[model samples]
Every structure is written in structure tokens, then in C-alpha cells.
Target: MKQLIVIGAGQGGLSAAIYAKLKGWDVLVLEGREQSGGKAGGIVQGDYLLDPGPSIIILPRLYEAVFAAAGRKMSDYLVFDKLPTISRIYFEGSPPLDLPGTREECLRTLKEIAPQDYRGIQDLLRKLGSVAPLVDKTVFSRPYLTSKDMLDPGLLQFGLRFNPLRNYRQMVDRWVTSPLLRAFFYGFPSYGGQTWNSKAPGAFLIPYYMIEDGVYFPRGGVRAIPAAFEKLAKELGVEFRYNSKVNEVLGNESKATGVRLTTGEVISAHAVVSNADKLSLLTPRDGDPGWEPSFSYFTCHWGISKTIQGLDHHVLVIPKNFETGFEELYDKRTFPTNPIVYLNAVGALDPLAQPPGKTLLFSVVTAPAEVKGIHWEESKWNYVKSVKSELRSAGIEWCEDDEEFQRIQTPSTFAQRDGNYRGSLYGPDEPHRLMGLFPLGNRDAKWDNLTFCGGSVQPGAGLPMVTLSGKFAVDLLSTR
Candidate 1:
């Protein structure tokens, strides 16, 4: 078997290792962390186990496909409980709206909430349906290698189905009339750390997936995702070196040889697949285009003695001034003073997540990588104060006396703990133009045996997309 080395054992790295082993390659996964899953791992505080990283599991099929491709059953390795109510959104001075798993149920909820705008909601769903096929068929399935890939027939089909001229926000405004509903729709861009006005095409499908296919929770926790993949990789004879960080990619002028670990140990391989952030490994060239970093999170995981009523598993608290909140995050590059909060509780799906009669509240507020003129060291407490205030306003009133455990993780923490450049959740936001939708490819054209995966590279961010990125890297390497 030809030797292959993979740096970082996150979702993408684990997936790549599994695939590479199946292809008859000797694979080794080098991880800087104590365990796998990168940002998608879980933490335990006393009796409560909290998944502070990725709280939502939108697509289970992607994981199943990977397991199936490896000649295994995903259900045997992992258990997923599909959510009926995807998210319950709360807006200031308005009644809370629960977004159901099925489109029909969601439409009924919309009709009940806003009788006059029911027809417009129907139009919106129809438009989303037309746009969704293109997404499932073309965008998500493959990587864009060159400028020529943009001209692929599937991309042309996508353009013809959806309006090529109108941006995502403009398209949303065409059908959604209610102010609260519009605010709810705009937040979809945040999934990729993009603004509502971004011209990114695939963002329109986020709400569609949540409503149509439904959100889910792994039986154990989010950590179970990587745990299953790691288990598969180990069974396939792929070796993992936990806490062994790769110091550098050893390569000649045209091809990568292997890697040198921080412990002064060097391992050689035929190809190197880096699942770390691209910026952490590669420096951009002069003529190459530059992009701003994606928004990172300031998360608070609270273990409370009691659960709050009228709150679903997932809830979004939209700000009274939602636009300004986003502007502060992406445009101003500062903490959102009036931030939208994504608060989740997983106790319903997994009782082990919290103690009996106790609940875990995992809250995330979007923050910039580097706040202008302000250091997170001095300002993170203030941000936590703001999020707590927002939680109170949204009706999750808990006492300090009842709190069993509390820990705050900011973007700075990500940089220090996970080696993420500026703690960016995703690499960069998708460019709004048709050409911009094409992210950086998996393989480096200049370096033959060097490839990249995870959120920073092509087929961009989120759990499912990064999982696909790993497979795409192997596919590209295998063909070469």
C-alpha cells in the first residue's frame, strides 16, 4: 500500500482516512487535539455533557453515504433521531413561531401566524423547490477545479432554474412579507458566516433542508459523529496519533513528501492531505484573490437545574434590529451589541446530556475574528453579559444558584486550543458573484501531492460540506 499522511482528525480528516484506507493506502491521521471532531466535539461538566461546537445536524444522508461507500452500515455505528420541530424562532413583541420538519407542517404554521401572507409563503416554497434541485444535483456533489468548472452544464441548469440576477435577500423579499418572517429568513446566510445580502446561491437551500429533510440529533451527542468515523477508520487499519501536531509539510518544489511533527519526528508519505485551515499551512500568492475571515462564535454552555417551558430543542432569538446586528458582525467587524442568539438544548434527545430534572443550554453569538481596536481578552466578559441579557429577554430566566456549570468559549479560545486561525468557524464567506460561488479547489495546482479539505476549501463549510470535502480530496488524489 502507498503511504498517505493526513493532518488533523476532524470530520474531513477522518472521512479522508476511511476512504484512503479503502483505496488500499497506508493512512495515518495526525491530530493536535486530545481527540477527534475538531470544533464538533463535546465537553463534560460534572454530570452534563454539552456539544458547544456544531449543535445542529441538518443532513444525515451525507454521513450515511460515507459509511455505505466504505461497505458499512451507518445505523450500526451511529443512531440519529430526526427532529419534528426544526427550530422555534422568537422575535421581539411577536408570538414565537415553530418551524416544523416537513414543508406542509411549516406552511400550516406560517398560514396560522400570518393569514394575509399565506399566498406569498406558497410562492416562496415554490421558488425554493425550483432552486433546490440544482443545489442537490450540482453544487453539493462536486468540487470546482478550474474556472471552466463554472461552465459545467449542471451549473447552467442551476442558473436557469433560479434568478441569476437577484441576490439572496432580494429573492427572499419577493415573497416573504411579514417583518418577523423576513427577519427569520435573513438569518440563513449566517450558517456560512455570510450576510443576508450576499449573492451566494446555495444559502437558499438551508431553510429548505431544515424544513423539508428535517434537523437531527445523534443518539450520544454531536461527538458521536466523529467517534463513529474514527471507529471506522481504526477498524480499516488507519492509524491516528492524537496530540501529535504536524509542524510543517515537507515537500520539494513540485510535490509534497510528508510532514515533520512538533516533537522533531519526521514521517514521509507519497501524498499529504491537510485538513487544517489553509491559512495555517499555505500562504497566498500575490495575484491570488483575498477574502475576509468568516464570523466566529462566542459560546456559553450552561448546566441548569431545570428546563424552560415553551422552548424547543433549537431556538433563535432574533433581535429587534436584525440588520444592524449583522452589520456589526460582518461589516463593522465587532461584537453584535444586539446579537441574534441561537440557543439549543439536547436533553430531550439524549438524557445523558444533562442530569435528571436538569437541562443544558448551549448558546452561540456571532463575533468577528479580530474586533477593531478591541482585544477579546478584555472584552469577552462584556459579550457574555450581553448574551445573558438577551437570553433573559427571550424568557430563559435562570438563577446563578441553580447553575451547576458554566463555561465560555470565544474565537480566541479556538485559536489557542484548536489552532484555528483567528478562531474562524468557516474559512471565508462565499463570494456573491456567480464566479465567486466557486470556492478554492481541494488540490493545489502548483503542488501535485498536496491537497486541502475541511471548511476552508472547496464545497465550503458546515458539517456535511466538510465531510464531502474529505471525500473530494481523496477522489482528486486517486484520479491523479
Candidate 2:
């Protein structure tokens, strides 16, 4: 049996291991951390379970497909429930807009709130829905190995329907006229580490997926998704070694043989798959210019004493000066004074998320990736105060007294913990993006038997995409 070694037990790494094992490769997964799940992992504070990463679940079919490929049922390992209220959009000085799961309910909400932009939003969804199949076939199903791959006829056809050259703001502006709708649309780009000016019309698919397919939540938590994959992988005879960090990829310029651990132990394999950030492994080649680090997140996890009314499972708070916030976030490379805040109150859906009578709130604000002169160690507490003030203004009030425990994660935390490049949630910045909309390829140009599967690699970030990336990595090995 051919042996394969996978570095990182993240979603992509675990996916790659399972897929490779199914294809008759003996698989071993090495994780730097003590467990699997990578960023999707949660923290336990006494009786409280706080899932700090990836609150919303969309396109659950991607996860289901993984189990299907292994001739197993997904429900047997993980159970997912579709959320009725996807998110409640809060704007300063205005009635909050509640977006229900179904398209009809969403349209109804739109009609009630912004009647003038109703038809425009309807039309936008219609157009995106029409071309969604084409996108899945051309963009999602394959990796862009070369410049010619980008100009593939199928990709060009999809591009015709949705112009990838146009910026995200331009695409949304073409449809909705209301500032509320625009503010909602503007945030999707940041989901993929792009800005409003990023040529990523693909970001529009986010809202389409949410309103059409319905957002889902796993029974346990976001960590349950990765736990499911880890369980399935173990059943399939894939081995996992925790706290075994890889220091380097071992091979020559033409082929990758294995990986060298930080402890100086070298393990050989027929092929190596890396789930680490691609930037950490491969250097920029000709036509593949180096990337500019993208935006990251500033997250605060609070275990409050009481539940806040009107707070849904997912809530997006758009500040009054959101335009200025965007400008400050993207162009100025500074944290927005009035940042758009995302709150995930797991207790809203799952009763067991916290101790009795308490609520676990995970709040996120988009901040620029770690750069010089931005001293998070010194300034993080002040920023936390600002974020709390913003949250108070939006009606979810909490004081230092109300807090059972408070924990925060900055770019520094992500960098040290997950080994993320500059602590970016998504891989690369927009201007120097390796591939305009698509992520870097799964197959390495320098090493023949090395492939990558993660947020930084092909198919882009998010739970579903990273899960799909594992399949892409295995596919490259099978093809070769």
C-alpha cells in the first residue's frame, strides 16, 4: 500500500486523509495542536462551550458529499438543523431587519423594510441563481493550475454571466439602492478576505446561498462539523498524531518525499499533502506573484449572566458611519472606529451552549491583518472597550459585572495558535491575489507529489469550501 502523510488536522487535512485512504493510500495526519478541527475548534470554560470560528453553516451538501463518497450516511455522524431566522441585520437608528430562512420570507422582509429595493434584490438573486450551476461546474469543481486554466472556455462562459473583473460594490450597487442592503452586501467580500473594491463578484453567491439554501447549524456546535470528519476518518483507518508539528517539506526541486517535524524527526511517504497555509509552504513563482496579506478578525467571547432579547443565533450590526468604516478597514489599513460587528449567540439555538441561565456570545469585528506599529498587546483592551460600546448602542448591553468570563483572540493569537500567515482568516489580499477570484492551486508547481488543501488553496475558504478542497487534493494525486 502506498503511504501518504498529511500535515495539519484541519478540515482540509482531515478531508484529504479520508479521501486518500478511500483511494487505497495509507494515511497519517500530523497536527500541531492537541486535537483536530484547526480554526473550527472550540474552547471550554467551565460549563460553557464557545465556538470561536465559523458560526454560520451554508451549503451543507458539500459536507454530506464527503460521507457519501465513503459510502456512509452523514446523519449517522453529524446532525444539522436548518435555522429559520438566518440573521437579524441591525442598523443604528433604524428598525432591525430580520432575514428568515426562506426566499419568500426574505422577500417579504425586504418589501416591509426597503420596498424600493425589493425588486432589485429579487432580480439579483434570480440572475445569480440562474448562473450558480455554471459556477459550480467551472469554478468550484476544478483547480486553476496555470494561467491558461483561468482562460478556460467553461470559466469564460461563467465570467460572461457574472463578470469577475467588476468589484463587489459595483455588482451590489448595480442592484440595491438602499444603504442597508448595500451595507449587508459590502460585508460578504470580507468573508473571503477581500474588500469592497475587490474584483470578486463571486462574493454575491454568499447571500444567495444563505437566503436560498437556508443557513444550517450542527447539533453540537461548529466544532461538531470537524469532529464528524475526524470520526469518519478514524473509522476508515486513517491515523492521527497530535502535537507533531511539521517544520518543513522534505524533497528536492522536482518532487516532495515527506515532511520534517519540529522535533527533527523525518517521516517518508509516497506523497505529501499540506493543509497549512499555502504561503507558508511554497514561494512565489513566475506568473504567481507573492500575495499581500488580507484582513483578519478580532473576536471577543463573553459568557454573560443573562440572555439578551431580540438577539438571534446570528446578528450583523451595521454602524451608522458604515461607509467610513469600510474606507478605514480596507484603504487606511486601520481598525474601524465604528466597525461592522457580527454576533453569534449559540445559546439562542443550542440550549446547552452555556451554563444554566447564562448566554455565550462570540462577537467578531473585521480588522486588518497584523502589520508593523499596530501593537495589539497594548491596544487590544481599549479596542475591546470600543467594541463593547458599539454593542451597547445596538441594544445588547453587558457590563464588566455581567461577564462570567471574557476571552479575546487577536491576529497575534491566530498567528501563534493556528500558524496562520499574518493571522489572516482568509489567505491573500485582493490587489496581489494569486488568482483573481479563485484560490491557489492544490498541486504544487515546485514539488510534483505535493498538494495543498486549505483556505489558502483552491476553492477558497469557509467550512464547505475547505472540505471540498480535500477532495481536490486527493484528485490531483489520483490523476498524477
Candidate 3:
């Protein structure tokens, strides 16, 4: 049996270990934090159960299939309740639109609120629904080997359906003239931390992932998924060590061998799959190094005293100024002037998140990649004030001026805790096999006797896809 070592026990890492164990490999997972799930983590504060990130997971169907592949069932280890409403969209001053789960319901809501924009919303959905299956087959399923591999007759036909060259922003401009509907569609680009203007219309699949897939909440929290993974891994003989932080990727002349931990332990292994941020692994040292890591993120997790009734289990609130909003996040080297707020109130379903008469709200906004520790004190206070002001400015109220159940985290803090490349909470970017983003047979890794999995590797970030990345890694390992 090939001994496999996985670094970083985040959801992706834990999932990879589970998949590898199912394949009968001797698997060991090394994690920096005491728990698994990395950025997709959970914390318990009094009656409040705070999901540090990944507030609620959308698409319930994917879970069962993945769990079964690892010799378990979703019902056996976890439980979740379906949500009645998905999100509430409020842009500018139009009447707030509450989006239901079904396609008919969403169309009806669009028609009821923005009658003029309804036809466009319908057309966009029609176009997307028409081509989404093709995208899953032609782009998402097939691993990319080269740009030359991108020449697909099906892709051309699908591209023509969605007006491919226009970009998602341009596509929205032509379809929904209302600021509310525009914000409704464009707000999804946040999933990949992409700017709406430059975001590829190819991402329209996100709506499908939302409306078609159906969002859900674990009985515990988002962290429950990874915890389930950890349990499954242990049952299959995978070893886990928490608080074991690794600082360097160890190798000789040609390729990576294992890792060097912060405690001065050089653990050797036949293969090393990193579940940590990809860019973090590339941190350059004073003496020398290889490739570097990429990007940064600032995430704030807070617990609230009251239930946020207006929002569904998963709500994405767009700022009044959508375009100007992204410009500040990407170019200004600061937090969004008017941040796009995303609220996930899973407490609606899993009432265990907070005390009675209290709610758990995960409200987050994008901050610039330029995070320095120097001015963070002022930045944190400013972020709190700005988020509160934006909500009140839009007539949404949940907290008093003096409510103090909040905590702010900057990218610099992420770097200090665990070496994240540019403080990227995820990795440099997600790997799409169909896009040829990750091409090594069996997930098909390119490096021999060595493969990369987790968020930064092929099949990319998110819970399900990362497991697929691990499955692919094991397939490659078998051939050797």
C-alpha cells in the first residue's frame, strides 16, 4: 500500500483523506488548527454556533453521492433540513424580492417586482438552463490538457446560446434594466472572488447551482460536513494530528517529497497533497524558493442577539452601488466603501445556532487584497461602522448602534496564523479539469510520484469537487 500524507485538514483536506482511505491507501492528515475544515470552520460561543466561513451549503444532492463513495451514507453521519426560502434581494429602492427555490417561483417573483425586467430574467434563465448541462459535460467533466483542447463544437454552440463574449456584466446589462434584478444576477460573482465586469458569463451555472440544486443547512453547522469527513476517514484508518502546522514543502532536485513543519520536524512521504491554500505553500523565504502563492481575503464572523427575519437561510444583499462597489475592493486597497453584504441565517432551520429569541447571522463583505497589520485597528472599526451604516441606509435593521457581538479578521492575521499566500483564505484559484486547469490522469496529476489535491489543485475548491480531486490523486497513485 502507498502511504499518503495530506497537509491541512480543511474540508478539502479531510475529504481528500476520506476518499484516499476508501481507495485502501494508508492515509495521514496533518492540520494546523485543532479541527478540520480550514476556512470552512465552526466555533461555539455560549449559545451561538458560528461558522467561521461557508455559512450554508447549497445543492443537497451532491452530498449523498460523495458520502456513499467513501463507504458511508449522509444520513448515517449527518442530518440537515431544507430551506423554504433561499434569498432576499434588495437593490437601490425597489420593493425587496424574496427568491423561492423553484424556477417558476423565481420567475414569478421577478415578474411581480420588476415587470419590465421579467422577460430578460426569463430569457437569461432559459439560456442558462439550455446550456448548463453542456457546460457540466464539456467544460466541468473533462480535464483540460491544453488550449488546443478547448476547441469543442459543443462549446461553440453553447456559447452562442448565452452571448458568450459579452461577459456576465454585459449580459446582465442587456437583460435586466432594473438595478434590483441586475444586482440579483451579478451578486453571484462573489463565489469565486471575481469582479462582475471581468467575470466570464460561463459562471451562469452558479444560478443553476443555486436554484436547481437547492440550498441546505446541516443540523449542526457548515462545519458538520468536514467533521463527518473526519469521522469517515478515521474509520478507514486515516491518522489526524491537529496543531501540527507545516511551514515548507520539502524536496530534492526534481520534485516534492514531503513537508517541513514549524516544530522543526521533516516528515517524509511518498506523496504530499496540500489542503491548505495553494498560494500559502509558495511563500518565498529570505534565502530562496520555487513558485509563490497568490491572493488574499478578510473574513469576519459575528454572533447576533436577534433573529434576522427578513433574510432566508441564505441571503446575499447587494450594495446600492454594485459597479463602484467592486472597483473599491479590487483597486482601492481598502474595504468596500459600500460593501455587498451576504447574510446566512442557518439558525432558521438549525435552531441550535443561537439561544432562544437569538439568531446567528454570518454577514460578510469583500476587502482588498492589500492587507497590512499596521492600520488594521482602524480598518476593523471602520468595517463594522460601514456594514451597519449600509444596512440602515437601505432600511434593513437587526442590531442596535451599540450591539457588540462582532469580530473582524484581516488577511494579515490569516498570514500570521497560517502562512497564506497573499493571505488568500482559499488558494490561488480553483482548478477545473474540463478547463484543463488540472490535468494528470486519475485527476491526472502532472508530477510523477507526487500529486497536488485540495483547494488549489485540480477540480478546485468547495467540498464535493475537492473530494473528486482526492479521488483523482489516488487513481494516479495506483498506476505508479
Return the top candidate by lDDT: 2
lDDT of each: 0.80, 0.85, 0.64
The residue pairs that clash in candidate 2, if any, are none
Q: On residues 1-480, what C-alpha lDDT tens digit does candidate 1 reach at each position?
A: 799999999898998899889888899999988889888877778998877688789889999999999889999999998888888888877777788877788889888887778897777667677867677677678888777778878777767766778877787787677777777777677666666666755676777777778888898989899999999999989999999998788877888888888898999999989898766566432132345566678899888898766667889888788778867765677888888898988788878898888888889887786444658888878988888888788887788898888898887887678666557666655462226665567887667887888877777778898899998888888888
Q: List the residue pairs that clash in candidate 1.
A: none
* lDDT minimum window of 10 residues, candidate 3: 436-445
Candidate 3 lDDT tens digits, 139-160: 4454344567567777667766
Report the C-alpha displacement of residue 150, candidate 2, in angstroms. 1.4
Could you give the candidate ranking by TM-score, starting with the highest?
Answer: 2, 1, 3
The segments of candidate 1 whose C-alpha lies over 4 angstroms from its true place after superposition are 283-291, 429-434
TM-score of 2: 0.96
C-alpha TM-score for every candidate: 0.94, 0.96, 0.86
Runs off by more than 4 Å, candidate 2:
163-165, 282-291
Q: Which candidate gets the maximum TM-score versus the true structure? A: 2
> Tens-digit lDDT track for model 2 on 91-191?
98998778889878888988888899888888888888887887788767888878777888767776678666667788888888888888888888887
